[model samples]
Target: MPFLKTAKLSAIAVAVVLSGCSFKEDRNDIVVPIIDAQPAQSSKLQFPQETQQKTKTVPTYSYTVRSGDTLGIIAQKYLGSSQRYTEILALNELKSSDAIYVGQKLQLPTKGLKQPDELQSSNSNKKSSDIEPNKTYPELNELVDSQQYNQAIQWILNQPELSNNVELQEQLVELALTQSKIYKRQQQVADAETLLSGLISEAPLTQNNQKALISELSTLKAEQELITAKRFADQSKFDESYDILLVAWQQVGQPLENNILFTTTRNKVSEHYHQKALRHYRSQELESALVYWKKILAVNPNDDLALVYQDRVKALQNKLENL
Candidate 1:
């Protein structure tokens, strides 16, 4: 009986040792503490709003009916010139030019109008440094497309190229702007994934690498915004302005003081509105035409087309009233 008990105790010890050896260190189980946590969204990675409100406001007036206040004098004071007698007559609802009464109330009108224009500088040193880039970009594209990419690249990479070459400058400006934006975007993406880098304490030993993959994906999305902005600008140029503004529009956010693209585009668009106003007058849509004409006059009162339409409409309305 004593021998049997001793044998049984030995068997128990062997069973315990065997159980420990069979126990596997769960290699398949994963416990990722570093939360891959979804990538954060930023407003910068969004489409910038287009179509800002006009900054200029129409002039308001407060005039007094002083003694010996003649219409010609009123025109000169308010209109910046005394030759606008007609404007005063129209504003005051006077039937005759000679009719004048003492102590009468009159709100004067200015026959002349001036609107904001592109600001200019006469300083030569400042002027030389201000010019658009990408002037040669289009030409370079043309050359490259024609199987002369090496020559095109070489010309663009010139150390001291022509300053007056608008096309070449335009391309360089656009490329520079795009590259800068991309670099900034990449930096932001890297910042967003800064915490993920800590998870890879020792790289080669880990078999599962899902967290690394997620980080890379987030970076790629940030890059998409810049590409999207460029594509939209390109599309707008293709549709409305064409090659006239394609490069300039893309380089708009750059540090370009001398760039005429913004002013040129504004002028081109304003001219289009005036042209539409003229067409409406031709179609006899007088009231609708008048509204567009006013906008044109507000932008540029000196426009002959707007002036012609304005006079013709006034005559037609006067004739109708007489009948």
Candidate 2:
């Protein structure tokens, strides 16, 4: 019986050793209890209000009113429809469509609106120095189609890659021409001329493009002079009007000089000045009369009426001085 007890004790020791090996084989199972004991104390400590406060605010977008930015154009650019300009009017509490001015900051709708960087990234495979012309052209055309000429010009100028883009250079020239015509139509002659001149100086225009821009500039100047002369003549400032017309005639050449509007305006101004000269001559204001006659001759150097009147004025002056 003692021998049997000794054998049973030996069996118990073997079982304990085997159990330790099993535990060693399943060592990974011990980690669960340790993990459970240390429950996420930090998560429990987090306040709901603090968590809410940490949540990000919905972002908004805005645009600044640049030169030549109309509500329709702005809406087309930012909101994707020119017709949505009314939304801008409502948002800004603007009573008139004409109320927005350059440098005004306007908040844009967030929906469907992307930041400029996001637009640049998603629209084109752009590198630091190069851009995908195909993708970029459509974006530029949108601004052009909206008649946002100045903004389009600014956009093109800001793109450094456009400098080497021959197609874009040509497009810029065409866009400038179109914008100049619009400015001329609006009677903003100076603006039209300045826009052309600036593009001529800044753009890498082809020879033909340069010629076209220069020609347009000349025509614009002539048209402006004619308008100013007509306005002065209407105001009865005949001498000033005649002087302006004379300058325009001398400056412009060929078809422009022979333009019907210019010719008609010049004749009207000259005749008005002639009538004033006649009045001065009859009133014995010889110096004033001579001044008008001489100006008329300066414009036409071969005017029979002006030459005859000028001679008569000089002869009369001599006679008066002798007397």
Candidate 3:
């Protein structure tokens, strides 16, 4: 019994040492790491609150076109440059700058920021005193006084400096008058009238004796209209010629025979209107033909050709109605 007990005690000591060695091997060879649920440092991906942006709303407004309000003038008032008139055209969906009429409503584009070059151009335009007109006007005046009309016109057009100078503007109108008179003498009536009319159109409100000048220009213009109308009638451009005479006659209060030139042109256009009516009649366009015949009778009830054509068209219209 004592030897059996000794053997049991020795086996128990050996088992305990084996278990200790197994624990030591686990400690030396295998490892488990501790993990954290939260980060140690703040994230670099986070943006500052101030860096966030909100959407912006664009602004818009409406405008009305008053009399004498050109696109350039409007642009100058609002956008700061006459050159920016094209921007207004795009905003309004207008095909041409000339399409706007008095009392027309235009959509104003007020949001666009001015480009650097455009701002510079606006500044340059506002500072036209940079060009000393005193140095330039004497030579231009000499060209006018000497009757070098073409040269004077070319010089005036080329110099943007002369635009706002009241003294130079008056001289320009006088030069234009001289040019028109010279053109009339040369029988270049179209050129004469155009120059005079353009001058009157652009003349500023502050000028002296502007009404008298306009009256003189109007008389000359009426005479040129008659001359051009006669030329058109001779070329068989009857409708175009008559249209010119019609405008002149209306301007002069639509008198029957106030001036010999007007009377002559009226009679000539009356015959032409009758001819145009006959042409329309030959093409079986009796209704259309009656329009020109009526115009002829309106100008002169005594027109024999117009009376005949008018009667013929009315009879044809009656026949068609009966059928």
Candidate 4:
């Protein structure tokens, strides 16, 4: 009885001492319990954190998606142009018709538009003081408001008022080239992540470093999903991809708008859409297919494939009208 009482007293003394040091103990406590009671979610939590940090290196804005938020509205609110929504889709890995649930995330960037500050200032420069829409702009900010920044500088070269503003026109061309360089820099990170995925193996491994590997692989998996979605107009059998690409074509439609970065690969996207349109047209989706072909011809007026498709679209239009 004496030993039992002494043992109980000893246990109580030990508990009082341990509780004082419990905070320190928790620093290393229960790191991914080996017991099957709670599944290891540490890696799941770390994956998004790492990817979010990685994207911060680019000139992008992070937006937490709210209910009823479409990429178009986000673009209009953040970038001032609803037309730049593809930039949102590319950064966020959203699908054409996936119907974003509440609590989704998005990334906003300077693609196809100016910074928010610059957009506001552009409007200030173009007040009633300027008589002509085509007045020569010494700086990129001139005459470019939020809604028009995407088209503002380029409009100078085409407008009648700026016909003699050769010096300002040339400056706009130089800055357009700089924007292309920025675009390439953003793509480099995406490419590096793709390469990392190929190097990492998915084979089951020891628990020691599995958590780290799982974290890396989850981000790579999301990147792969986005890249795959980029390749098709109807990814996941949705019909919205064609319209998305249609908007992209319009952003860089005319040869006048094409710069070093956009010019070299100008035909690439157009060509991709041209074939996608044919595939859809053959399936009897004439309107959808014609929509794509028209976008292709927007960039290249004489594009032969689009020309052929246009003729067919006209014939179909006539037939439908007669019926």
Candidate 5:
């Protein structure tokens, strides 16, 4: 009986050891290694209001508006349908599709196309700088299609070999003009003037086509100046407005008298000067009135009204001097 009890105690000790080992193994099983969690790619680009559904993830692209960019054109190029312009309007909270302005940021739903980052990754298989001009053409074309005119121009200019390439140079001219137009539309007058002037200086001004483009750019620049001057004049900043108008009027390339934008702004500026002259005249400030009248005549030399006003003011000035 004593031998059996000792044996039983030994068995109990073995069982307890086994049970402890099992408990330790279970504790070990419960412990998980901590990993440094990586954020999902979509989260990086997502807006606060954007929610992903159970369907496959759709990529989005952000585009900046250039001149002549309409919602229909943007939607058709990026979303595969002009009818999807409503989607853009809705996404942007725009009252109308036409309300988009140059330089405005647009969130585009790239229905079948990859996002810009994904496109860059795929294009990374080949270094853009090492690619031949002919090979780089498609990428530049894609930039134009995306309304990324400035980027396209920079890419072309970065390629030293492309300087002598006539086709690429012509493309550069067009892209530069487009970018300048966008700048003008956005009221970035200095940027527009700088880009257009650079392009004009680079092109052979004697070449018919190059000359035509230069003239067009100059005319556009003048028109933008006129618009800007009129805006300033409307706010009663006559001196500032007159300075811009003087530059625009003396641009010397194209006669802007026939251009509608030019005509409108010119008329508005003239009216502002004429009104100022009348104000001085009413206050019996004949000399100040003559000065304003002469300012109007400086812009429009053939203005019958300004000529008559100047004559009348000068006569009043002479009479006041005599008195």
Candidate 6:
């Protein structure tokens, strides 16, 4: 009985050891599933991070057009180049450079656009070695005072140091205006127009200054037309004179309206045409008379004399055709 009881105790101890081994193997299977689950979660988290790292965005800006704002001026202010005006034009889908109006909004590309502080810093850097250290404003004034206009202009334009000098720019504009007047006095109309136009484009002029320059240029062109028309009239080329004056009257009538010289020349040319028309009318050349009458009416739609004569010549032409 004692031996049987000892054997039974040994058998129970072996059974307990086998069950403990099976429990350890089940725990390992559960832990492996948990470890594999961690790798799937890590991959999902890393994918979003990789996608976020790959994405990027560019920036853009908007600008409002102010009075005296030009594409060239805007480009120069923002892009550091007046030549980039074409880019502005393209961005805005503008067919004409003159299409922008005051208060109009424009989209500006931020790429390469310089901030005001950056532009100033660049100017400061440029001033260090690019300009003549000894050149001064007083010396420039001396050139203008001596009436060395060409040299003064060259100095103002060629000096990069004067790029940000507003006072010097104002002086350059005034000097250009004075020189243009001298050219006009010398009967150099083309030269005067060219000088004013060049200053308008090249110099950083204020709105009022630019407007004044444009007005002067228009007046110069009108005066040149008057001179040319009178020359043609003196040669008895009434057709050429009439055509030239007509174009001037149509295109630059506002500027010519206040010009005494233009008005006087226009009146003289009109009278010449009227007299030639009268000769043609007296000779019964109705077609030729009508041609001159129509030219007068084209220039001055309110010309009572031209209106009556045109009516009479047309009536006579109809009468002759009917007979």
**Clash number by candidate, in order:** 14, 0, 0, 0, 0, 0
Q: Model 4 over residues 1-323: C-alpha lDDT tens digits? A: 99987775455344434433211222123221111122223343232454444445467665665643455445656776554655665675543322333344556785555454423566457533232333434343554433243355355445564334455444333333333333335765454443323323432223423333344444334333433335542333323433443344444233223233333243456656756776765455667888887776555443434554465466555644444
Question: For model 1, how many clashes?
Answer: 14
lDDT of 1: 0.41
Candidate 2 minimal-lDDT segment of 10 residues: 27-36
Pairs clashing in candidate 6? none
Off by more than 4 A, model 1:
1-259
What is the Å distance of residue 150 in model 2 from its true position?
Answer: 2.9
lDDT tens per residue, model 5, 115-149: 44325555458532332234557888777777777
Clashing pairs in 2: none
Candidate 5 residue pairs in clash (backbone atoms < 3 Å): none
True lDDT of residue 268, candidate 4? 50
**TM-score of each model, paired residue for residue:** 0.24, 0.37, 0.30, 0.25, 0.36, 0.38
Q: What are the per-residue Cα lDDT tens digits for candidate 1 across 34-138? A: 112112244432222321121213342435434434444345445764445456545544432123333334444322543312344554344322333334356
Cα RMSD, model 2: 42.8
lDDT for each residue of candidate 3 in 144-197, tens digit (9 for 90 to 100)? 556676687567756666566666665555556566667767888788767666
- RMSD values, in order shown: 35.4, 42.8, 39.2, 28.3, 33.6, 38.2
Which model, 1 or 2, shows the larger TM-score? 2
The total of clashing pairs for model 4 equals: 0
Q: How much is 266 displaced in model 5, in angstroms? A: 2.9
lDDT of each: 0.41, 0.60, 0.55, 0.45, 0.58, 0.61
Evaluated at residue 58, the lDDT of candidate 4 is: 61
- Pairs that clash in candidate 3: none
